[model samples]
Structures are given as C-alpha cells and as structure tokens.
Target: MRAATKENNVRTCLACGAKSDKGALLRFAAAGTIIVPDWRGTLGGRAVYSCLTTDCVARFYTLKRFPEKFFKGTPAFAISQGEIHGWIKTQAEASLAHFLGLARKSGVLTLGQNTLADILENGGTAPTAVLLAADLADRTLREITGIVPVGTPVLRWGTKETIGASIGMRPVGVVALGRSPITDRIVHYCAIVNHFSQEH
Candidate 1:
C-alpha cells in the first residue's frame, strides 16, 4: 500500500475545531435519514469528522452538535444520541477486530505467552503494544507485564479463545502487535474502546 499523501489527509474536527490527521478522527456519514459512524472512512456521502477522544465524542453528543453540523438547513432526522453512541462503540470494537485479523495475515502479530515474552526480552525492535487476554492467569499476566518495557501500552482484550481464533491459532493467552499500518489503527480503535468503557 502506498503512503497517504498530505494534501487530503488533514481534517478539522467538527466538535473540537482542531486539525488532526484524518485517520486520527472518527468520520460520520449520513445513512438514509440518520447519521452513522463510518469506520473505514469509505462511505459515499458528506462526512463529518470528530476527535476519537471521549471529551470530543461527549461534547458532540451532550451539546447536541450533530443536528446543526449534519443537517444544515435540511429537516432534522429523529436520531437519538444513544443510538449514535452505540454505533460509535460498535464501530470502535469492529475496527479493533478487523485490524487484528489483518495484522495476523500480514505476519505482524506474535501469539502465545512465550513468543511475546521472547520479543520483550530480546528487544531490538519492540512491538507497538501488547495484548493480554482478559481472562489471562494472574501469574502469566504478571510475568509478561514484568518483561514488557516501560512506555509500551498493554491492553487487556477478549478471551484467549477469541483472540486465538482471530489469529488462526488455538486458544492463546498473550499476543504482541508489531509496528505496521494495522498496528496504528488497532491502537487508535483500542483507545476509543477504552474511553467509552471508562465513561460508562
């Protein structure tokens, strides 16, 4: 995949009014009479952008900003804030899942506790982040956490079986995400997931 050029890559968030790389913001597109989250940013319609952070997302909803920004002079659709929030949460989770699958296919994912631990210990190039199974054993979690270098984020996500299936392997407790386009996307979506979880 060729790198994205700079000209069409910057977008201003409708909520925050701050400029950021397009990929760093969530894109929403009109779907029929209602606005919906556009996770892949490929929807064929006018798109509104917002920062993925909870503050921006919350401001977008709490201040009732979407109607003015999305509808303009057109008659407003009867869209509920709850529905939009649900869509945002669903899309965030789906984005994370989709990138994990891609990372696996591209050979940028390391599976199993020992494999991830080896990467951490041998440390020439380190993974962008580590993923621990939500139900991972306390002993294994501590062992892996101890080995991971400072400043690298560790995310607890999914069960061992679910994560393993995503990577086409048998159930495994730990995985490491290496540097790649997919890794960047995974990190972004993970932040959205974490933010929403904390707020609710």
Candidate 2:
C-alpha cells in the first residue's frame, strides 16, 4: 500500500518466497504488540511483505511464525487472512478514489465520453491511462477501447455514479488521466484491485 516505489524497494513475499517490487505486495508492520498494515509505508516500523493473492496471503499467516520471525517476539496475533484481505480491498479502493480526486483537482483529468473522444482524436494532451465505469455501455466500451492508443492502461472499475462522484460531477462513464505521479499510483492500485477481484 506504500507509494508504489521506494528506493531499495525490493522485498520477498513471506509466503511465495519470490522476490518482487515492494509496492506489488501487501505490507505489514508491527505496532508495539499489535501488528498493523503499513498501507502507506509511513507506519514507521520494520515491515513484512505478502503477495496479494488469497493463497499467498493465507499462507503467510499459517507459517511457523509471523512473517517468519522478523520480529523479536511472537506478539499474540488474532488477524485472519480474510480480515487482511478485506483491509487490503478497502484500502485499495479508497486509494484509487483518493488519487482520482487528486487528478481532478490537479487538472489532469478529462471526463465523459465526448470530451475524452475529442481529446483522443484531436491530439490534446494524450492520456496516460483511461478509466471506464464498470457499467459503461457496451458500445461506448468498444468505441473507447478501439480509440485508446496502445500501451495505455484502460481500467474498468466503479459505476458511472461512483466515478463521477469521485470527480465531483454528474454521472460519467469515462475518465482520462494525463501523466502525473498520481496517475502512476492510480495504476498501481488498479492492479491490486483488479487482480484481487479476479482471484476472489
């Protein structure tokens, strides 16, 4: 949940034993005797990593010791895999919404189909990514998908109302984000949410 990148940001997954970028994994840190999530990496403690997949998340907790004994003592832990997963889902959802709002306030957002289509066609600031409402009409989805340039991420999440409300507007189905640090973070959260949704 940390900012998608930190220097020396590499961490090993406690369950899978595979090395990956720290931002790609869920992060946990011990708070005194209670373990807490470093959802933003600002929790300021020694941290552990776990893959986002349910199997890995569950496996991480069932290990012989918490985070394989990274801590000095086995603090009595009561958290379950399902609870952790719920926290992750909620955090990721909120993070995405937070970034989207930031994008709008920062003037990096293009809203609705007509505006987005015009920008794409007329060569306005090319979007780095696109977000389509989960309930976007099929015809609009197809049209937008075909128009978006290759390699640009097209994330499908939230409904028209949810997406529009995030930007403080009426119901809108499409949102285009220009290049920005916030956009990159949005992409990262989208991956977590999308991957978790698929697995569940």
Candidate 3:
C-alpha cells in the first residue's frame, strides 16, 4: 500500500487566480465554517487564504466557488454570510489598536480624535485605517476617507446588547488607550463580544 500524500492546503488567489502557500495570503472563515481571506491574516479560526486587496476579496465572495465545501447540508444552506466581513473588520481594528498603542507608549501619538481629524482635514497626516463601533452614530471617518478614502476602516459588527456591559465598552472607535497590536486585540475582543451577544 502507498502512503497518503499530505492534503494540499495551499490557497489560490481569487483575483489573479494564482496558487501559493497558505502563508502568502490572508485567510478568512465565512458562513461560520468555510475560510476565505483575513487580509491581515491574523484572525484565528478555519480560514481560506487570499491575497490582500479589496479586489481579491470581492471576487472570492462574489463567485462563492469554495463555499460549497462548508455548505453541503440542507441543499440550500447559508452558513454565515457576514462572518468574513466581520472578521475583516475585527482584524483590522486589532491591528491598528496594537500598533497605535505601541506608538502611544513611545509618545508618538499626541493627538486624539479632534486633532487627528484636523490633521486629516489639513492634509497633514492621514491614518492608514479607522475602527468604528458598529452601534456608533454620526461617524466622521467618512470625511477623512473622502479626503483620503484610501484608508480602511473597521466597523463594529456587534451591538451594544452584546458588548455594552464589558469594561469600557463603547462601540465606536478607540475609547482610551491603544492595544498592543490593533489587529490581534480587536479580533479577540470581537470574538468574546460576539459570543456573548449570540448566546444571550
């Protein structure tokens, strides 16, 4: 008898349709089970990797080619359509928080929201990304993005009912103090908050 070869866990890029090792791309798990692209490639769980950039992500979701593996039951089933989007938002926030926290510790970030907005308006400094609480209303990040829409923003997917009771829970942007690595912390926080919201 011949030994079984290792399963080819390598992923193919949805955009260029290029094949590469899993580590080369960002993976995300959608429909609660299937993996897609995490962009930052930091979020935990079963994920299918894809190359960075919105184009690749859009292709993966639009075609829904690989989703068959996880949606085999019930004939016409929808697992978690929002899972991939949620993961992306959470991961982005975590990455920003972590790095910003480090920068804050180093006394690099002296400006808060107002100052940051001012800088953005004046074309002085442009943030790489923005994280907003899902429940937050009257968001100003749009203006920042309009002036420089190239920046990405992470919006909260959980409601206040889920994370309202948590320590310093504010479903908007960074409340106070940045986390070690924004992506890691945001992902972890979203998981906990989402679990509670789903349970009770």
TM-scores for every predicted model:
0.83, 0.84, 0.35
Native-to-model Cα distance after best TM-score fit, residue 57 in candidate 2, in Å = 1.5
Runs in model 3 deviating more than 4 A are: 1-12, 18-25, 29-47, 52-55, 62-79, 112-200
Overall local distance difference test of candidate 1: 0.77
Please identify which of the two predictions, 1 or 3, would achieve the higher TM-score against the true structure. 1
Ranking by lDDT: 2, 1, 3
Error of 3 at 198 (Å): 25
> What is candidate 1's lDDT per residue for 1-200, written digit by digit as tens?
88878957998887879999988888878777666667688988788888987678666655444555455544333346556556677778877878888999999888877877666677657778888888999999989888888889898777898777777788888888888888888887877777777745
Q: How well is each residue in 78-170 modelled by candidate 2, as lDDT tens digits?
A: 466567777777789889989999999999888888898887788877789999999999999999988889888899889999888877889
Arranged by TM-score, best first: 2, 1, 3
State the C-alpha lDDT per candidate.
0.77, 0.82, 0.47
Cα deviation of 54, candidate 3, in Å: 4.6
Q: Write the per-residue lDDT of candidate 3 for residues 1-200, one digit (tens) a residue.
A: 86644446467775568787664455665545344444555665545555644456556556535545434333211324445445555555454445544554554432335665666668764454444445545555454345434524443543443332232333333322233344344444444334423421
Residue 138, candidate 1: alpha-carbon lDDT: 98
